[model samples]
Target: MNFVYEKMMGGKKGLTGFLILATLILVIFPLFLDIFRLNLVGKYLTYAFPAVSLVLLWGYGGILSLGQGVFFGLGGYGMAMFLKLEASSVENTKIQSTPGIPDFMDWNQLTSLPWFWEPFNSLTLTILAILILPAAFAYIIGAAMFKRRVGGVYFAIITQVIAVILTILIVGQQGYTGGINGITDLRTLNGWDITTDSAKYIFYFINVALLLGVILLSRLILTSKFGSLLLAIRDKEDRVRFSGYDVSNFKIFIFCFSALISSIGGAMFTLQVGFMSPSFVGIVPSIEMVIFAAVGGRMSLIGAVYGTLLINFGKTAFSESFPELWLFLMGGLFISVVMFFPNGLAGLWDDYGHYITDRFSKSKKTKEDSPEIVEKKSDESAA
Candidate 1:
């Protein structure tokens, strides 16, 4: 029990923070917000998946990937393909020249489903693809770069370039990828209509549950020996490499793990948003994801979720009101966070929260001791 508490929960303080966050999303938000707002929060939480992944990858492992959207888009597209196929049944798509293919494919004059898309006909295959494909792709990328000892700004630039390239590829391959519009008109999942409010509520709960599970899993990893090694590699790669450890392998594993997490977010995003698009697969969204982690404090997994929620909420509110100025505001917010609060909200809490608590504690102690001290002094004078 002690071992589990220490290792899995990060002791008392970690457990307290986790419970507070869980209560906020699970109890507070659901109770206060309406369905539409709650659903929007669910969408924001989907983005949190990648944010949390960044906490592990960039924060701990020191592997900064600016191309997480690639994994995200892949996962979303995998699910979208299945849903689109299900929605594009022969009976439903009979009006199209190519019946049973995606609408975009028919419009593009593709007579048959692509070979790569055939497996998505089955839900099992789709799920497997969402789970495995991103990690596999990450493995290829990680091994190529890390094994070659390529990192730092070069790696970051390479990831950004990959994001750009993928966005272009998806946009260019209109027939295969649904083009710039992306895979749209996603209607159902395994014959269950996902357009209803009930469905949104259900998906929201499921997403929250999965997100909490991911956080716990990540916390477990960070508390383990392997996590310690990741930090060592991040701080002193040469020394760790010289100590007989294969540093590249650790980076590769974490990179793949982060990709897997981001892909889960992508899949959930498709379900919630009812579509996938190249807009989400491009450089801007990828950078926004990193900003979510940065604003929340990269070292703190739970903080990542809050950071995602805060930034997205601000985006929605600011965009709704200011519209034209939101982008500039967002840019300024990021600048401020980077310049003054580099450690993020979590860091601020760590730095000042204790002082507040300590002040209160001292005051309380002084109040309790006043009566006793006065009584002791009076007794001595009387004697």
Candidate 2:
């Protein structure tokens, strides 16, 4: 058990952190928050998927991608295609000129389902698309850039540009891609109504489970030989390449893996939010995701979740009363984190948490060595 804990959980500290986060999300939040608030938290948790991926790719692997939203949107659109089809049954949309297709397509005068969207009519195919499309897209990008030794700021800029281009494409192809409004009014999944309160609870739990699973998988990768190589590549790529390692392959693999993780989040977002939009597929949300990682301690997976929740909660709260100021507030918050708390909340804890622990330990020792306690022990021994 100890060996397993050490290997899988990073020993006691890691295990404790995982358990605490699990308790907070899985138990405490559900017990305290009403269903509506819990649902919002679930949405925030979905965003954490990308944040966690950023932690792995940017924090650990030293690969900063500024367009994770691209993969996220692909996954979301895949699931949305399935749900939209389910909701647009011949019976449901008989009034439209083109029955059995998404309303948006009918509104655009599309007479038939697009060839690409045909695959999403099946739940099985939709699931596969959600899982496969993002990784494949990421592999192509990573291979192109990493193979040519193009990285750092240049790679970041390329990713941002791709995000912009993809958003423009989605917005321009109104008949096919749902345009700027995005794939909306998603209603069910494989015959199950996903908008009911009960469904919300179930989906929230599922999201939590998937997130925990992703974190564990990421942790496992971090503790393995591959993880060490990732760090080596991040720190000294030329040296690793000199050591006979195919550096680009490692970079490509992690990039693909991170894209896959983000896509899972996107799928869950569609399930929970009942829609997917091009708004989430742009450079802004992608950068906000990075801020989540940065504020949560990019080096810490669990911290990513907290960072996501904190920032999103702030956005919601601030937007309620001062909507115009929220963006500026967020920008300021990001700047503060970067300038003053670069390591993020996790770094602050690392810097200060031990002081509390030390105080408790010292008090316990003082009690154990107190004169009265020592005299009592001596008396007991003599007796």
Candidate 3:
């Protein structure tokens, strides 16, 4: 969809979105859902962060990154490291050979903490790493690819390979990263036990708050001239270059921004889910992230959140009831959505909903006018 910046991405439309999200977060979900279900929605909202970024990158910037999982993993593991350090205090690990180190490290026969893990002992440093590491990695990747005009399928392939490589590295380094199991047993953030239901409730609100901020940020960007430039680059990169814009710089910026968004989601995921695993940092999950954006309406920021919720809800429902058919069903949904509704749920609504609403309004107006017309006719006949 070629989105008109003024029409779709403007602050007015974003305000409507903000109100809807605020209502859902502050009123609807809290009042309607039990804690368990609310937490599940929180998990779904976390994925929406990355999905919104994908809408920026793929839908507007025309950059399809298949390695978003790597950034997500980096952010998640960054947070996980700090949480693990807190959980593995000397008192907690008194039975371990290395009482001050993480239990997994002790299990693997390590005597001292790895140098890389040292920084994570500080929460401030961990938060900084979570933000910087992903953006730095994205900068390198985007600079290398966009500068050389490598994009589309080739860029996508490279990203997919990167995801696979990172997954292998994390899984292979058992002693360092907890291997295929990834980071687990995270108990607390500071002194507050994050595993408690109360904590989950708090984190859910936090997730919603951050996600809303991101949506507003994205809307601000998309409504700006730079957003038009991105759309132009997506449709006509060579023309944009001919027009004297630094296309590669814009690409790099969007790439880094997308990474930042994905990382934030990852960090929030770790907080809510209580674990960060290699399973989330791989090709399958990375692609699934894109599917969330596509299913929502790649050009619609607010639509992405609803899309993630609906898809995840369906996945959870189907997988629990008919495990064997869930994959087939999900695959079919993806295929059918792409094939039949290229613009996704938002597109469908825009196309048919306006027509329905217009018809309803016209009918109601005619009904009101009929009473006035009949009253005038009776007065004229009496005269």
**Which 10 consecutive residues of model 3 have the lowest summed lDDT?**
4-13
Per-residue lDDT tens digits for candidate 3, residues 150-210, read 9999999999999999999988889999998888999899999998999999999999999
Residue 368 lDDT in candidate 2:
92
TM-score of each: 0.92, 0.92, 0.89
- Residue ranges of candidate 2 with Cα displaced over 4 Å: 354-383
lDDT of 2 by residue, 1-383 (tens): 87569867876567767887899999999999999999999999999999999999999999999999999999999999999999999999999998999999999999999899889999998999999999999999999999999999999999999999999999999999899999998878888889999999999999999999999999999989999999999999999999999999999999999999999999999999999999999999999899999999999998899899989998998898788898888778778877998899778767876675567678999999999999999999999
lDDT by candidate, in order shown? 0.92, 0.93, 0.89
Model 1 clash count equals: 0
| Global lDDT of model 2 | 0.93
Lowest lDDT 10-mer window, candidate 2? 352-361
Give candidate 1 misplaced runs (Cα > 4 Å): 352-383
Kindly list the per-residue Cα lDDT of model 1 for residues 179-202, writing each as its tens digit. 989998888898999999999999
- TM-score-wise, the better of 1 and 3 is 1
